[model samples]
Every structure is written in structure tokens, then in C-alpha cells.
Target: MAGPRAFAAAASLSMLFALSPATAQTPPTESIQIGLSTDAISITAGFSGADLTIFGSLENPDPLIARQGRYDVVVVLEGPPRPVVVRRKDRVLGVWINLDSEAFENVPVSYSVATTRPLQDIAEPAKYKQLSLGAQNLYMKPVDETDSPATIEEFTAALRERKTATGLYSENVGGVQFLSQNLFRATVRLAPNVPVGTHKARAFLFKSGMFVKESSAQLEIRKSGFEQSIFRVAHDYSFLYGVFAVSLAMLTGWLGRLIFRKD
Candidate 1:
């Protein structure tokens, strides 16, 4: 009787072991989708204070597994002949301030990403990692007659000139190191003296010093009303002061003339 019972128990355990492979062999469902705000975007001349939106989608196919989702979005603006400046404002308490800036002329713009979901629930984090979100230069025309399409030599020369002109502004801010991949935010600040015109900017992705993909965007710098206001103020001040001085002189001369006529 004891031998029979022990053999039966061993047989049950063997059957459970046989079923474990089937349970473990179930494939994980892929539940993520990616889309852009548009297939293409365009910016016209004198464009400023413009906002570009990037859109993406996430879906879950498995009903049993509850999933949490998160994403990291990076926008890089690139220009070939000249470097473009990207700036982001950080809110501290109530005041907003410029947080950081990064310049990319010859090189590509790059940053890292982190999601809100855990690794297990991400479905395919590696797939999201492979997705490229950036731009490239199709063509860059000169803004001025003297200025020509930028060559490699011209780019290098402009970089040197920029360094000399600006004398290196902020290196780091808000405890974020500039040019560090660890941080998600980076930008390139346009020089104050940057010529006022339309400039082409491109965006691209890079891994291990090799180009993976590319896209393109545009940047336009035109005279603002604020600039005109400054000149208006100066002209008004000059005209008012001149009129006041002339009125004072005339009044004095009139008083002298009346006194001499009485004498």
C-alpha cells in the first residue's frame, strides 16, 4: 500500500513539471505605438514665439497585466551654416528664468530619455529607445548678399567668432551640467548680434558618434515691435527736449524785449 501511494504522488509532481513549460512559454504582448504631430512642419520667415508640438501614442493589449506608461520627449533644432540656439524657461516659485542652453553646429543634438513606467510594465522599452525624434538640414541659404552658403571652413570660423563675441556665457544652471547626457534639457542661445533674418535649423539623432537619423526645421529672426519702441522712445525724448529748450529761450527773449521797450 505504501509503495503504491508514493508512486502516485511522484506521478502527480511529474505532471505539474510538464505543464510549467507551457505556462512560461506564453509570449508578452506588445502594447506601444508612436506617432508624430504631423508628417511635416513648416516655419515661415520672421517666425518667433512659435511653439512646435510632438505627439506620441501608447496602448496596452494584455487585459490581465495592468501597465503604467511614461515618456521622455526631446526636441532638437539644427542649422548647417550657422548654429541655432535653443532655450527653455524654468519656473522657480513664481518667476520664470532661462534654465540652460546648448549649441550644435557641426555636431548633432542628443539627449537621454526616461519613462514613468517600470521596466516590467513597459512592454518594449527597447523599441521606444530606437525611435528617432529630430530634424536635419535640407538646404541653408544666406540671409545677406555678402553672406554665402556656409562651408565647413565657414562654420568653424563662425564658431570662433561667436566664442570671441560672447566670451562664454553661462556654463551650467539649476544644478544641471551643460552637454551632459544625464540631463534631459539642453538648448543653444542665439547671440545678441545674430543677424536679423530667416535661418534654417535642422535636428538629428546620433549614437556612438555615427548618424542614426535626421529631420529639418526652420528659424526666423526678424525685427520686433520692441526694437521699434526703443527707437521711438529715443526720438520722442530728443524732440520733447528740443522743443522745451526752444520755448524757454523764446520766453526769456520776449521778457527782455518788453523791458527794453518800457525803458
Candidate 2:
């Protein structure tokens, strides 16, 4: 838990090294190296998504220029897509019943973002959309062939609200903190129901309120151990899996009857 004061100290020290004459004449380079804490995430019966720490280094291309204004770091992590359906239920004469409904396809199962500051302060909407820096820029399309744009927008907003409630979609302004002038770290907590597949993690470095260096990484999340085996068999041989499940159920029932029955 590095505090702001500690980070400021580190930043100051880092700047000193950058300014020393040992290697001061190098060409200016604006770049970043970002990576995840783990390459793969495995799940089991009680599996819940885990906390992932993303860290990176930003090259101090020119200490003089960097000192003029601080750089902002924003990271966005998005998971595999799955179709979602949102429904509205209204209380009828006697009971509540579903009324209007909308279907969305290829929707992000999980989306989380962390930034050094508010995204708006980092970049304008147009620039942010171009770089896809925030959750608002993600394109979620309606599955219906002829839905009105306004209706689609309504559904999209609902989807975001639902996901946000479940911690699947989130925005943490000032979540990213600099450990040193050149180093940064952000912690992303994956939702327990995060989709199992490859996810994309992106980092963008902004200076002077403009997009600059950017990088992308991939994260793999899958079931492991017995859970992994069951998932594989169930998907690859659904018929066999179903038959086996029924047989197991019957066997359990028979055993229960034998143990309890007495005359």
C-alpha cells in the first residue's frame, strides 16, 4: 500500500536518475511495457475470479518535458463476449409479468477500467472513443434486425447498469497509481462470473491530454482440475454427458431407497 507521499518521493528520485549525465544524450522515446501478474486463470467448482495486478514502466523520454506536465495512465480490461437478454417486468392485474424485452449479441461479459484520473480529464470523448479508453466507447449491438437506435441505446444502458451492479463492468478513476515516476501499478478484480476465454487488456499513456503510447496483452481464464475435465466432456460429448448424468442420478436414488427402506 504505497501512499501518495511515498510515490512522490519515488518519482522525485526517479527523475534525478533520468537527468544524470551518464546517459543523457539518448534520443527521445515515448513507450511503455505492460504485463499481467499471471498468464492463465484456472477455476473449479467454487471458482471465483481473482485479483490481477497490472504493472508497467513508462520511458522518461525527456525528463525536462515530463517534469513540465505529468503523464496519465489508463488501462482497460475486457473479456469474451456472450449474448445477453434484458427484460422489463410490470405488475399486471394479479401478478408481475415480463413486458418489453431486448436482446443483445456479442456483449462483453466483463469490462473494467482503471485510470490515474477521470477519463474525461485525460481525453475528450472523440479522442477517447478513437482509442477505446473507457467503457462508454464499447459498441454493444442489438441482436434484433430492425431495432430503433434509441431503443438500442436504452438496452445498452440497461446492460451496463446490470453489469455494473454485478461488478462485471466498472470504472475506477484514480485507481492507477504511480509507484515511481516511470513505474505504475493497477489492481483489477475480475468478477466471479467472468466469461471463460481469452480477454484483452490494454494500456494507454496520455500526455498533454492526448493519446500516445499504447500496448495490448491477452489473458486466458479457464476451468481447471475436475471442473476443467467436466467442462471439456460436457461440451465435446453432450449426449454422452447427459446419459451419464441420468444414470448417476438413478444410481443415487436407488442407493438412497435401499438404505432407507425396511419392512
Candidate 3:
């Protein structure tokens, strides 16, 4: 009887020890989640640029890493893709002429990046290139692949410069802030001429200079009020709208002549 009792006690002790390790261990994987206050936004006419705020959270984050500030986040708002043609103008007999051109397919109309730190400090350039991130690293595939590499590179640089000048491509360092151990906020700029389409907002997480996870959300940007109505009419009734525009112009010209004709 004593031997059987001792054996049963040892077996229970072993089983408890085995289960303790499993319960004490937390999964090492961490993920990111982002949310938008609204799924769509309206842009009225004569509106200047504005900042858009995005909130996010870290899931299953390691407290130690968070406390040490080893975690980083990068947020990006990408506008809809469309075909673009980049033309180069050069002096021709003292008048600028469209000399050369390059066409690219599926170019992003706008791209805004907000990061916890400067991009170079967050990760290697190769990583960003691999992710097709940042205005400088984004890949712009040329429509004519057979074009000389030098020409393509020049046009690509020109396109990026033009977008930057227009406030369509931007980067904001230190735009992301950690509100708490697991919560973060990011602010990205929206240009006044932001395209009306479906945009995607993405968040990337990095831990100790290593990519951890990513998450995304969708947003719709569209015009509102009188401008929106006119836009819809122009697209939905092109022929009628054109006729009305022509007639209105003609009437304006005749009225101007009558109002101030030299006697």
C-alpha cells in the first residue's frame, strides 16, 4: 500500500511540472492592427491640405521590448493607381517643347508616409525597396521596357520630383507616436488635390530592426457639395455637359460684347 501511494504522488508531481512550462510560455509572435475613425472622407472645394490621423494597436507585444523602445511603426497612405505620362520639355528656338516622354502603368496618384523615426534609422534601404515603400524607393515600371535604363531612371526621378513639388508625395519623420505600450497614433498629410478614389492605409511593425508584421485598412476619398455634382454630371452625361458648356461660353461672350461695345 505504501509503495502504490508513493508512485501515484510522483506521477501527479511530474504531470504538474510538464503543464507549468506550457502555461508559462507566451508566443513570441507579435502583430499590428490599425483602425480609421471613418471609412470615407469628403473634400470640399477650395480646401487646402490637411492632416489625417490614424490610430493603431500592437497585439501580443512583449512588454520588455515595448518598454525599451525597440519597437517601431511606419504608416503609409497610398492613393489609387492610374496610368501616368511624364513629359520632358526642352528649349526649342527659345520656346520650350515637349522633347521626350515616358509612360508608366499603375502609378500611385499619391503616397504619404509617417514613421516613428527617419526611414534609414528604421530599417535597411533594401528592406524598403523590397517592400516598395517610400517615394524614393518606390518602383515605377516603365511602359516601354526596352527603353534605355538611363532614360527610364531620369524620367522616374522627374516624376517623383514633380509629385513632391505638388505635395502628393511626402514623408514625415517622427510622425508616429506610441500612446501606450500597445497603442500608437500616426498623422499623414493629405494634399489639397488628393485624388478621389479608394485609398489604402498600411502599418508596418518592426522589432529590433526586424520586420514583424503588417496590417491595413481602406478609406474612400471623394468630393462633396456643388463640385461633386458637377463632377458626376460631367462623367455621367458627357455629351450634354459639353453642349451646355459651349452654349454657356457663347452666351457669356455675346453678353460681354453687348455690355461693353465701343460706340
| TM-score on alpha carbons, each prediction | 0.27, 0.80, 0.85
List candidate 1 segments past 4 Å from native.
1-164, 167-185, 229-263
Which is the leading candidate under TM-score? 3
Cα deviation of 6 in candidate 2 (Å)?
25
Q: Which ten-residue region of model 3 has the weakest summed lDDT?
A: 4-13
Residue 112 displacement in candidate 3 (angstroms) = 0.6
Q: Count the backbone clashes (under 3 Å) in each candidate.
A: 12, 0, 0
lDDT by residue for model 3 (92-153), tens: 99999999999999999999999999999989999989989888999999999999999999
Residues 1-263 of candidate 1 have per-residue lDDT tens digits of: 01111000010011111223454468332222222323333322233322222222222222232221122222333222444543446798989997643344433221112222222233333433344221112222223325333443354345434443452211111111111111122233332333444443332322222233333334443444554455556578978767876998999999889988765
Specify the highest-lDDT model's number. 3
- The superposed Cα distance between candidate 1 and the true structure at residue 200, in angstroms, equals 2.8
Clashing pairs in 2: none
Q: All candidates: CA RMSD in angstroms?
A: 22.5, 6.3, 15.4
Distance from true location, Cα of 257 in model 3, Å:
8.0
